[model samples]
Target: MIEQLQAFTDSLPPAVQWIVVIGLGVIPFVESYSGSVIGVLAGLPFFVAVPAAILGNVASMLFAVFAAHRLRGVVRGDRSEAELSPRRAKLKQRFERFGVAGVALLGPLALPSQITSAATVSFGASRNAVILWQTVSIIVWGAGCGALAALGASAVT
Candidate 1:
């Protein structure tokens, strides 16, 4: 699948290939890291690829965070908290232990930024706080992974 995507991306006119990278970055599992790698491997300049990927991933994640925030507000009105399942209890424990910053920073290791950002908001965290931390996390992860991919790609060429 990745090979096919890369081939497809390579087929586009070079002037607009970064646009496809931005679109790929918006996908959940693909996100900025994979998107940047794809863009670079598809022969985009590193500068163009990484930033485009980060922009798309951040935009999508922001949407998820805002939607989750709105949904939480609507669903939480005047209701007592329901009992959590054992799975949810464990997740809650982790959330409490890690807090927003830790989760935002480390979440990409386990899940996509969209899921992490939304979960943080659903936990009643401040929306601005989640956005701030998630942005930081996205930038760091995207840049780090993109750099590594660039290095590896150069080594092979």
Candidate 2:
């Protein structure tokens, strides 16, 4: 799947390639980290690829956070209470222990920024804080992965 995406990205005109990279970055599972890797592997300049990926991912995550914040407001007004599933129970436990920053930074290992940001917002974390931390995480992960992929591509060439 990644290889196919890389081929597609590589086929684009150089002037607009970063746009496709940004689009890739907006996907859920294929967020900034994978987008950066794809962009770098597809021969985009590192400066263009990493920042584009981060921008797209952050945009998507911001949408999720805001939507979740609004949803949480509506849900909070309701009287219903439901038990957490086992998986959700575990996630809640981690969130309780780690707080927003830790979860934002490490959540990418288990879930994309969109899901994680939404979840964090649903759990009643401050929306602005989630945005700040998630942005930091996106940039760090995107730049780091892009750098590694660039190094590997250079080595192979």
Candidate 3:
């Protein structure tokens, strides 16, 4: 799937390719880290690819955070209806165990940042705090993954 994304991105003009990267970044599982790596593999520069992916991911995440802020009241109003599924239960447990920073940094390993971020906010975590930590994680993970992708691509060539 990522290889197909790479092929499709490579076929577009550079500006549109960035747009494609950003589009993929907005996807929950794709996110900035994999989006940046896909961009790098599609031949975009690391600087451009990483930032574009981060911008898209952050934009989508902000939307989710704000949406969660509004939905928190509704969700909270109905305790019985809001009972978590086992997956969400585990996510909530992780949030309890790790807090925002640890979850922000490591949550993607288990679930998309979107899911974790929303879950955190639903648990009454500060929106601004979650956004801040998510930004840091996005940058770190995107850059790290992009760098490794570049290195691997170079070695393969």
TM-score of each: 0.86, 0.85, 0.82
Tens-digit lDDT string for candidate 1 (13-91) = 8657867888988999899988888788777778989999999999999999999999988987766546566886688
Clashes of 3: 0
lDDT of 3 by residue, 51-123 (tens): 9999899989888888998899876785763677888787677677889999899988988888878878987
Worst 10 residues of 2 by lDDT: 76-85
Give the RMSD in angstroms, all C-alphas superposed, for model 2. 3.7
- Tens-digit lDDT track of model 2 for 3-78: 6666776787876887888999999999999999988887788998999999899999999999999998987786
Best by TM-score: 1
Q: Candidate 2: deviation at residue 107, Å?
A: 0.6
Q: How many clashes in each candidate?
A: 0, 0, 0
TM-score head-to-head 1 vs 3, winner: 1
Off by over 4 Å in 3: 1-11, 77-94
TM-score of 2: 0.85
Off-target runs (Cα >4 Å) in candidate 2 are 1-11, 78-91
Candidate 3, residue 40: how far the Cα is off, in Å: 0.6
lDDT of 2 at 43: 70
